[model samples]
Target: MTRLSHSKHNSLDEKDYIETLSQKRNTSKSRKVLEVKSAALAAAKQHGLNPWSKDSLILYMCCFTSFLCSCANGYDSSVMTAINIMPFYQTRFTSGVVGSTTGIIFSVYTIGGLTSPWIAGPITDRFGRRRGMLIGAIVICIGSAVISSSNTKGQFISGRFILGFGVSILTCAAPSYIVEVSPPQWRGRMTGLYNCGYFGGSIPAAAITLGTQKIKSDLSWRLPLIFQCVPAFVVICIVWFMPESPRWLLANKHDEEAHAFITRYHGGGDPSHPVVELEWHDFKEGIATDGADKRWYDYSELYKTTSSRWRFLMVVFMSIFGQFSGNGLGYFNTQIYAAVGYSNYKQFVLNLCSSIVSCIGALCGVAVADRLPRRTVLIAGTFASAVFLAINGALSARWASMPSDAKNLSVGQGAVAAYFLFNIVYSFAYTPLQAVYPVECLQTNARAKGMAMYGVIVNVFGFINQFAGPIALKNIQYNYVFIFVGWDCIETIIWYFFAVETMGKTLEELDEVFTSSYPPRAQIRKVVAIKDDGHVDLVKEA
Candidate 1:
């Protein structure tokens, strides 16, 4: 990674890289989750989902099932955001006059998210993507029902933990399922569409609670808890008919099913299609197994080889940098507005508008994620965010140094605008793209485990920011932006050295990039492969 120190951003070269590749390469498409999980949650399931349809409805529906599962994730993530605001929610049921047990109520979800991956990895890998999603949806459904029906604080807390557990498991399987099933050309937009649902769940969760805030029964908050199951069960029913991931089927030795899936979906019902045959050959050559012990705990394999090790660390670091990039601040930006001398009304408007902007960014990502190189989106996103934070910090610092009379001055307005723009840019790039890079970078065999690790790392960072963001806000005031600015710049450096372009390649073709020793910047479109019926070898691009 030290290679980053010598890295240079030659703008002309990047412009050429984007242009030449656009002209030369076959086109393709490309988050795992929301602000936290949105980018990951949208997609479908049913037995070959919509098998009777002559169009690609089956594939789209199957992926859409995953998106439905994400609604559970989004709902759960935002449920508390609204619940905490409702006086009825805070004053009811528990022995303390409320489930004011903060640790048990709040941290329990994070605990479930942190640990579920260990179980999720093997389940998704061994049983199949669809099966794993079913299990997650069922767990979340039960959790939602339990939560809505709970008569005591402990029961609600237990239910929260259970729902969190299920959401974590789906996060691992859903993104992997979407990637495995999607075609190379339209992958980005489809995945980005799922992210839209992530925000979709959240906005409604808040709205539903706010709408019922004055309702005098337990129904006020309980119904929202129960409603979380709507999307979860929707996914479960749909996924029942959807086809399992073609990649998972191939890796698990269901070669016939794998072959047929590509024929039906990727090639429009033609088994002899060139795309179908080439993809199979790529899978065959790329996944040559070493016959190692296939235990569930065999994740040590993630770091056993040099390329796998670098890629694993790369994914982990990206998660870390993203968290440190001050997304939590966006999540809790009302405090930011308060600190900057904005009224509560103004804060509410900004938050509402930012939500709309986030949706816009998700749509943009869908449009260009497939068109632009992955590395370009990542570096540009991080740098732009860092720049925004720096400007925000400057404004806040200026306001802080001025007399109290100057507190609500125009500098406060500038800080608000800068941060809002930051929110918009993040959704377009960092938030949605997070899911694409990891699944694309890893090989098929390790993808489930890799995604599981992705969850753990994200939660670990979330835990830190969860604790740190508030502390920085209270004690250090506006200067806290400097931490993220420095942190994001370092992250940009790491990405510059590690990000290889995965655009336009099949999941199998991505193997050609990571397995090579090429420096990061030159990895794409340079050391190309020519597979003559499963003999995979690289030749320099002429």
Candidate 2:
């Protein structure tokens, strides 16, 4: 009996010891979790910037200057859409506006774009973002003068070529500068806003053309052409006053300047602020003093590493997908409307109304840019665009062939509605992301060259779209719409399989994501603060 009682007591003691050990382990884990949560909350608070603050206002002003680049591009496109429908323009050109000649005139601009990236990449890297923008704007002003005064088709095409080249340089420099300088939390909205300026220029161009269309003179087209220079001129005036990108400063060894810039804009003049410290740390760790941006001819940096290749892949995908997704038809919206029994005057009205609706959609996109995941917005938007395009195609096929008097009024209106809906969905998905996604994907080292590469691809595909769209529209009519329907669906699948989620990370933190074997599948490791020393570390959650 004594032995039995002793054994039972020993077993009870062992069980108590095991239970105590388990309780201690649980306590340790709980403490660690609490520490992580506390640190994350602190970091969140540090990044919660006030938009109404003086520093934020200054940052916004700088970003707005960069946005003019997009506005310039939009104005030219919208103006051409309106001018193509004018009787004076057709009489002056004397080369039918419905066929291959129209295609050549439209495509010459993008051809000029194709020639720009080589010079733009090197100039932007060597001189600085501000100077690159200034040079491009100056060139645009000259191009505008030439085109507005042109008396011949060759002169008009040459002027447009110059305009394209200048716009390419502005596009590359402006987006890079905006991304590098914007606060990480506001990067999406600001960069997205940069592209939204497209609609800003478009709305005015449409309105001006609508007013000018009734004039029985070449000034109808010339006035709108001259207006293209306005946005670029605005950029040239304000960009000199804006601060240089912090990343550019850091990359060029202007450490003190970069630090001061960050402290003022990101930290509200507090050198010791957590946001300042974090930015400083990221710049120190991520930027290389002797990276590819420093070398004028080193294009290999974009493809030399697994991570960089993936980054460029995303750039390429976006460039091709963005241009091909039925928005290319935008430059010829009048023709699309004319096919459905609309008169020239009615076509101008529809074009103006469509531009306004598209602008609203782009603004809505800017609002949710940071709120939603990029992949979610892109996938949903592309799929929705496909559906609308298909609907438009079906309606156009049914009603476009009928005589105006015999056509079903409801069906014609439905087709127009479908076109309007398509613009809204396309603008919502693509306008905001056009510049934001490519800039976000590129690392500092590869940014300039990668953007140049992106420019080349965009223009190349843009050339195809502009040159071929008119021919295809004339030959296949509504069948061309089905092509995009199929292409957009394919693009949706590609985005689903390949697109990386870049919603919440800083430019530097993306390194971990890209460096992984497969970027799309890579998890964003949490950035945690070490309790012992105030340093941050990337920790994967269990």
Candidate 3:
């Protein structure tokens, strides 16, 4: 009995010692986590900034030029709504084939869109971001001049294609450039500002098209197309005034340039301070672990791993979802109005109202995107858009089968209301998603490549959406388009399930968040440390 008691005591002592050691280990981990959290918060706070800072203001000014450049995107999509109803395009360009020619004119731009990302992404990564912007601006200006001078359909198509190439480069380059150079706290807001400029561009484009409907000159349609060149010219002139992406410079091993840029924007700072070194360390470590110079951007990398595969799939679907939301289909709203027995002048006025609502929606989205979690805003906006589209479809179905007498006043009102409501919601969601989500989910090394792939998917779907709009209208009634779009509510459900919230995450944090749930999660780790002077350093565990 004495021996047994002695053995039990020894066992209990062993258990106690083991428990104490476990507690110490856990305590150490907890302390480290706390330290990391505090450091990250301090650094973010230290680097916090306003969107109107001198550098940011310059970016915003460039955004305005980009905004004007973006008008061509909206104009290319929607200009045909009015032009199709015009006598010139109908009789001359289409050979009286309004539907087919209209689709061709709109869809041809996607040809350039498909090729632009591949060319732009690698080049932007190699050359400076400003150079890409400058080239795109110059090309677009030349294309616009060509557009203004074109008399034949072939010439018009070629000019539009060239213009699209320029727009694609600008679209892919500008936001990423803005986000990369911006302070983390204000990155979303600045990118949002870029989006706001884009929609603002649309408002004037639509207004000009409506304003010109009264003119009898051949310039009526051509002038709007030519007017797109104005922004390109502005962008070219402003390109010299803008700062290049500091992050891109760092990535290119331009350490001196990168430090100068960060100091210029971050206030009084020693360029070689510990904080700056920390930031550089974090950036370099992230690139090394995340796979830069990895087979020189192999396309197979997208599908080789589960995480990458999922990312590619998500971005592709997101791009397709954005296009399929039926916002672009509204480009053919004039046809819908005409089919409903409305006159051209009335449709023009109606489109202008829709444009105004879209602008308001885009601005609201820019405001809310920064305020709310990105995924939530996107989901809510998509849901709202789906609801509006459903209502429009119901209204269309009701009117399509209604007697001629009841259709006159009520159908027009319903159509206009549906168009207005949908634009407002879609714009709010679209403008930000286009800017924030892609940039947020990606890190710097793969950011350009990831976004390049995203751009490709967007243009692919955009091409299909633009091409299908006319065929769908020709084969079926106008109501079918809204019905098709309303079905995208299903996508809202998909988005909620798969989408990650990214409202206020740092670039490094975002990189971690993306890998958070992947297999071997413990194998992939993120380490970010900030020195007292506000330089940030990060490392990723392999």
Quick one: best TM-score, which candidate? 2
Please provide, for model 1 over 106-211, each residue's C-alpha lDDT reduced to its tens digit, 9 standing for 90 to 100.
Answer: 5567567788988898999888899989999899888888889988888887887888788879988988888888866667766666656766777677566656
Summarize candidate 3's per-residue lDDT along 99-201 as a digit string, tens digits.
5666778777887788778877766666766777777778788888887687898998888788778877877677677777766556676677676665555
The reply for model 2, stretches above 4 Å from the true place, is 1-44, 401-405, 527-542
Which segments of candidate 1 are over 4 A away from where they belong? 1-53, 92-105, 149-154, 214-220, 288-294, 341-349, 397-410, 524-541
Candidates arranged by TM-score, highest first: 2, 3, 1
TM-scores for all predictions = 0.81, 0.91, 0.83
**What would you estimate as the lDDT of candidate 2?**
0.83
Residue-wise lDDT of candidate 2 within 328-432, one digit each (tens)?
Answer: 989989988887878889989998999999999998998999788889988999999999999999999999677766888788788889989999999999999
RMSD of 3: 9.4
- The most accurate candidate by lDDT is 2
Could you arrange the candidates by lDDT from highest to lowest?
2, 1, 3
lDDT for each candidate structure: 0.68, 0.83, 0.65
Model 2 clash pairs are none
